[model samples]
Target: MDLNYSPYDFGIHNDPYPVYARLREEAPVFRNEPDDVWVLSRHADVQAALRDSATFSSVNGLRIEPAFWGPDAERFFSFVAMDPPRHTRVRGLVSRAFTHRRVQELEPRLRELARAYLDPLLDGEPFDLMTDFAGPFLADVISELVGVPEADRGEVRRLGAAIMYRDEESTDLPPEALQAIGALVGYYAELTRERARGRRDDLLSGLLDAAEGDDRLTLEEIVGVAILLVGAGIETSMLTLGNAWYAAWRHPDQRARAFDGRVADWIEETLRYDPPPQALARTTTAEVELHGTTLPAQSRVLLLIGSANRDPRVFPDPDRFDLDRDTGSSLAFGSGRHHCLGANLGRLETRIALEEIVKVVADYDIDTDGLRRIHSTNNRGFATLPTNVTARR
Candidate 1:
């Protein structure tokens, strides 16, 4: 059977697993010439590529889209698109401010934010979970962390969403996306300057003050990191929440368990079953031979994270979403040096949101017919999930 895979395809965006399964079995190192990408679809291969960053570099941003790829990728992905010692230096400074203690301290506020949005949605009427809750909640969390003023957060969220979204089958960024990027960068650049003058008790202030020895982030670097947080941090967390909600709605047994306070398990299984980051793009730094095929130097490669998570070799009965199954090997947040810096905060936000959700929401039903998904080259999740809940008295 002939293999044809394009990440830009809307059909693939809708459900790429079947294609991924075929690629893993038939072409572990599949090459899609149309998109000019080398695909690695096995658990071991993807993991190895992630760990071997030297061989599979992130110099070109993590997405294959024309707008996000190449030398300027750092403008969008920040240090995530860089190789060491640049990546090492920038991540170290950012880490100083984005400490574990800081994330841990936000729990109370996160819980409050979750309930603030969830309370009105419990009026026994159908609502779009993405619009009414997940989007706003995660946006608020990121906004609060970044010190985006309360009044400006809605526009910030809109800009962030525009940057990640794609028109069906499009390979490059649209005009609106470009406009959003410019606007977001300007906004953050001003915010960084504002904090530089007088620090506040937020991440922006922390970023301004974050230092290692005599080194510090420049104004442009801080703006880039802020944009990265808005684009990568908020989008993935928001999508993950929706993905988790949908996964539970699809499986009654898992839904029941999740409702019974097994939210962490629910998150793990959902991440394994249908992760938000379906694929990650990398650039091959040197020639390499793998799976009986040789990939040339500087070739664009896509590590199929979604496929790797479902590889039967790593997880038994991988297709099934069992809350009890161990998901320690899942690459949902990636691995190695590029392992998500915001993983702790993402988990905290999700846990708080869901924990509060399970309190007010005894059970819920999703309108499958009304479901709509966001189309992007890599990310996967709903744009609109029409839902009705059975509120708890």
Candidate 2:
């Protein structure tokens, strides 16, 4: 099979499993000339690239281009684009706020919040699950946790969305979108400054006070983290929950089994089956040999996370959506030092979501025509998943 994989193609986004399988079998280290990025479709190849951060640096900010590789990009991206010592310092500061214990403690409050958002939709009325529930829930959770003022949370999400709406193929940049990112950065910077003046009971305040001595994150670093938290925390969580529902509704047999202790398996399977973050880019630091091909130094490589999770070499019957599938090796949240920091938060949110859903909704039907797939190079999931939610009782 002559593999032609373009992340921007809507057809591929809609159902990329078949194409992913073909790439895994025929061209594990496929070159997507159209996008000017090398793609790693197989699990072994993607895992290798992720593990060797020195060879494939994140300093170029995932996907490389003139717009994102500019000087200011370093200040804006902070840790995500950094290599070692800097990445360690920033990650350490941010990690304190998202500890396993902290996430566990958030459960009670999250359950209450989940109930507040979900109770109204149990009236058998049509609800756009993605827009109405999943999206808002994640936005609210992350904003509240990060200490964004209640009045400003909505605006933050709006601006953040605009900033994140990237089209890798487009040459012209959207001024308004850039402005939105600018505004968001300023918003977080102010929050960071306020925390510096006097500590508040929030993540921003915690970051300001998080250090024994001179070792600490600068104002720009804090702001970068705030943006990172929001960007990385929301979309994947929102989509995972929405896609889980999409899966449950589409496969009742699996849904029935999910009511028991197996819901965790269902969630794990969903991550492997149809993850939100479909791909991420890494820049080659030096020339590297992959399979029989040589990836030149300074070239861009797009790691097809969605494709890798479905590699038949790693997973049998790769196309089938099975709740019982063993997903121990799934590359959903990724691997290596650059692995997702918000992975725990995402899993917690997803579990609580499914638990709440099973409580209120025993049977639901999807309006397939009402579904809208989000067209993004790095993300995959429905933008709108309309369902007539029914109450259990």
Candidate 3:
């Protein structure tokens, strides 16, 4: 467990699976310099830490480099930065709105949305599937679900990109990122106000209702939670959709299964092999020991989720993408109290998206000429996915 392994090194910000595997083998609890963070790379280790919230607290911060706007930014985003009890309270309210049944009920609507957005692109020649299909589709779903007016989806999406894409290393001054954050916060506040009329049945309405209860959410809390949900919901799904398409196009056999309604396994396999979320970070609120290393209070821990997902101990031939493989349970959605609440929703979107893509893309080729990776400490995804798709009919 060397103290010199930097995930930021090895060109990992672009792609880090190889480095992750090396870490798992050499330093399961590798301490990364540059960021002064300890990384947990093994599947079992990551899963255990995720479940053991007491040892590895998330309260201090869940993000790698805390936002530039002081601790208020952290406190405002308490739902994401809080631990157990409080986290459970706020998350429960939102989770109630996104129940399995609700997501399942939304499947047909999602499929319809997918076709409406993609069929035209499919009819035309080559196009960027990420922009044409995934991005728009995810934005539409999140906008509608969050009670944002259909007319405002474009503005919402623009703000979403600004907030989600802005990174610690973003050349734009901190003020620019803060400006983007403010605009999004303003929009969410307005949306909350609108949802307050009690005239909607979407998730936003549910959240507003929950906010009015005894253990109610503060106005800032409501706004922050809304911003997180709106941004996280859409961006994560967009990443999943992009990665799903990439996997199908790369693995033809898996792509064939996807078209035939037997691709859930493939989707699961892809999630295991290349999770949209590469890492999850937690801060130690109290001194704790991990893998013989003492993580002092206030120390940061980065769980290399992508590496854990590909751990050979858990997944045989972990690097290979096999639709038929039996991946018992993967770290794609993470594990523990903070495991992704929208995992089922993400799966539903991916399954239907691939189904529709298969129906249209008889043959497709990834235009690897110029693909860009989203620069971020946590989420692993593509910024732009170029593809040449052929019509099935």
Candidate 4:
């Protein structure tokens, strides 16, 4: 496609690694003039931009949007999108609650949840893992962490999925997404009051109580952060579980090798191979020169994350989805200040889910024709992945 990459282009968005590899060699610093955004495909370039946050600001937040995508139809901003001090402060406040220990403590809960979801399906039947297992499993975990009432978890999942799976081709949000966002905002807005009224040992309660002297988060900000947490919580695990399993089934040998110690390896490879987040955009603060090209001030550059993860320089035999591929510190969760905050949680969720899947599911085959690729700007994965599984017992 002549280095003029359009994320809206269905074929490229679904599998842009090849084009990214080509661009890494031929046009490492290419520009999509139509979209008015620069493209960075190589690992070094993407990493450099990520590290040099001073030069490339993130005032734009985590809204790494597509050209034709909608306005801030459902604006939900968290610490993830902020720059420096603002990002630092908010992230610090929430980090106290989302600590590594908290995630570690969730291990048993995650394991139990995995079994709870998968065990019922182990009744020798075909099921859409996205709908029946992965989706609900992640939804429940996120709900527990956020302290959402059990009765309301289903509503939260439905709303989160609405935001997760939107029409990418539109310049404005579809009616369904808008309605879902409205409901999410309303629910969280009410939940914020609920948490404020009484205290609990949950992230939502923690967020309600987090502070820096008198400069606490506003009600809107609290709701925004809550929505962001739920959506991010649901999206990553859901995508990783479904994609990792799908990729595993496609490769018999690697799938076989994935049963034990290599389960983490398999999940890591899946992150590098086909991360849910395909790309992210960073706006330049001033004119910067790279690769013999001058990008002017205020230019937005799309870090081809999917491409960077598969960049041949960093990962040998890049395109092949090999679980054994030794990739060094892949940018699957990004890097620097804006790195994914939930990296550990996502890995834990995927690992636990996969461990359970291989236990009861003897052998499963993907329903190729039933696969539905989600059409978000940067997020890539299945909307529906129908799989027919056989039980060991």
* Most accurate candidate by lDDT: 1
Q: Report how far residue 129 has shifted in candidate 2, in Å.
A: 0.5
lDDT per residue (tens digit) for residues 40-107 in model 3? 99988899888888877777655565562224444435476677787888787766565777667777
TM-score of 4: 0.93
Q: Rank the candidates by lDDT, best first.
A: 1, 2, 4, 3
Provide TM-scores for the models. Answer: 0.97, 0.93, 0.90, 0.93
lDDT of candidate 2 at residue 390, scale 0 to 100: 62
**Worst ten in a row by lDDT for model 4:** 65-74
Question: Residue 297, candidate 3: how far off, in angstroms?
Answer: 2.7
Q: Can you write out model 2's per-residue Cα lDDT over 25-115, one digit (the tens) per residue?
A: 8888888786788888888889888888898888777544455653355654567777787777778877875577766777887788788
lDDT of 4 by residue, 1-393 (tens): 545577656888667777876888999889887767788888889998888888887667544553222234225556666777877887877776678887788889888888988878877678898988888899888887778898898778787777666564542347787688789889989988999999888877877777778767777777877777665778878898888988888888888888645889999999999888887777788999998999999887888888888877788888788877775668888899878888888888888888888887777889889888877656778888998888777
User: Which ranges in model 1 have alpha carbons more than 4 Å from their true place?
Assistant: 164-172
Residue 231 of model 1, lDDT score: 62
Candidate 4: how many backbone clashes? Answer: 2
Minimum summed lDDT over a 10-residue window in model 2 is located at: 164-173
Provide the overall lDDT of each model, using Cα atoms, as 2-decimal numbers. 0.89, 0.79, 0.73, 0.79
- Model 4: residues with Cα > 4 Å off, grouped in runs: 64-74, 167-172, 213-215
| Local distance difference test, candidate 3 | 0.73
